[model samples]
Target: MNEADVFTMLRDTILAVLIASGPVLALALIVGLVIAFFQALTQIQEMTLTFVPKIVAIFLGIVASLPFIYATLTGLSDRVFDLIGRGGP
Candidate 1:
């Protein structure tokens, strides 16, 4: 592949990675923030309190987003394989 084609593949790879992980990461961030707020309001500073909610939220987010993640990865894999099959220039 030429430089432009290589760059395009690189961009698509990054986008696919983001699409695969974005939901879980965003869920963790949001959950962590919410837990921090609640802790500040209640003055209940328990380390486990933050851990549990964020973990659960991240897990649920991953489960919910599995299909979308699968599709994105599959699409990326197909494109890469197709490029290989065509004897990439």
Candidate 2:
């Protein structure tokens, strides 16, 4: 691939990654903020309290989001493969 083609491919890959990960990442951020707020208010300050909820929230987010993520990744892969099949330079 030429420089421009390479750049476009890289950009597309990064966009796919961000789109696929966005939900879980946003959930993790929100969970962390909530946990921080709770710790500040109740002074629980438990390590597991901080970690467990974030982990669970992220897992749930991932589970809920799997279909969309899979579809997005599959679409990207299909496009990449199509380009290759078309004799991409």
Candidate 3:
């Protein structure tokens, strides 16, 4: 593959990775923010308080988003395989 083709492939792979990771990352951010707010209001300075709830919330978020995540990954895999099959470059 030429440099241009390699660059394009890398770009596409990065985009796919970002899109796949977006939901989990967003969930983590939202959960963290909410936990922070709760800790601030209640003055609960327990580290476990923040960590446990965030972990649970992130786990639940992952469970709920599993289907979408699976689909996205599978789609990306298929696309990559197709490109390879077609002798991309």
Candidate 4:
């Protein structure tokens, strides 16, 4: 209802999103970096090499982290819903 409350809500939402995405993004980033490094050392430049592993890693990461992601998002939703139920001053 107020500027502070609005900003706080926005911050919480953004943080929740970032935290929820962290696992997948981090896995992809690490896999990509490792593949790039290997390619650099071996001089084997294959586009599929980068795409395939990252895809698999991301998929696995998402499956493995689903619960953590759900909890993070659910917590944010609960807070938001509770805020709405409280009514603004």
- Compare candidates 3 and 4 on lDDT and give the better one: 4
lDDT of each: 0.93, 0.92, 0.84, 0.95
Encode model 2's per-residue lDDT on 9-72: one tens digit a residue: 8899999999999989999999999899989999887898988888889889999999999999
| Stronger candidate by lDDT (1 vs 3) | 1
Candidate 1 per-residue lDDT, tens place, 2-72, comes to 99999999999999999899988988998999999999999999999999988888889989999999999
* Candidate 2 structure lDDT: 0.92
Task: Answer with 1 or 3, whichever has the higher TM-score.
Answer: 1
lDDT of 3 by residue, 1-89 (tens): 57998787778878877887788889889889988999899998999987887888788888988888788788878877888898984
Score candidate 3 by TM-score against the native. 0.87
Off by over 4 Å in 2: none
Clash list (residue pairs), candidate 4? none
Q: Please identify model 1 stretches exceeding 4 Å from their true place.
A: none
Clashes of each: 1, 1, 0, 0
Q: What does the lDDT come to for candidate 4?
A: 0.95
lDDT of 4 by residue, 15-64 (tens): 99999999899999999999999999999999999999999999999999
Q: Candidate 2 — worst ten consecutive residues by lDDT sum?
A: 1-10
**Model 3, C-alpha of 60: deviation from truth (Å):** 1.2
- TM-score for each prediction? 0.92, 0.95, 0.87, 0.96
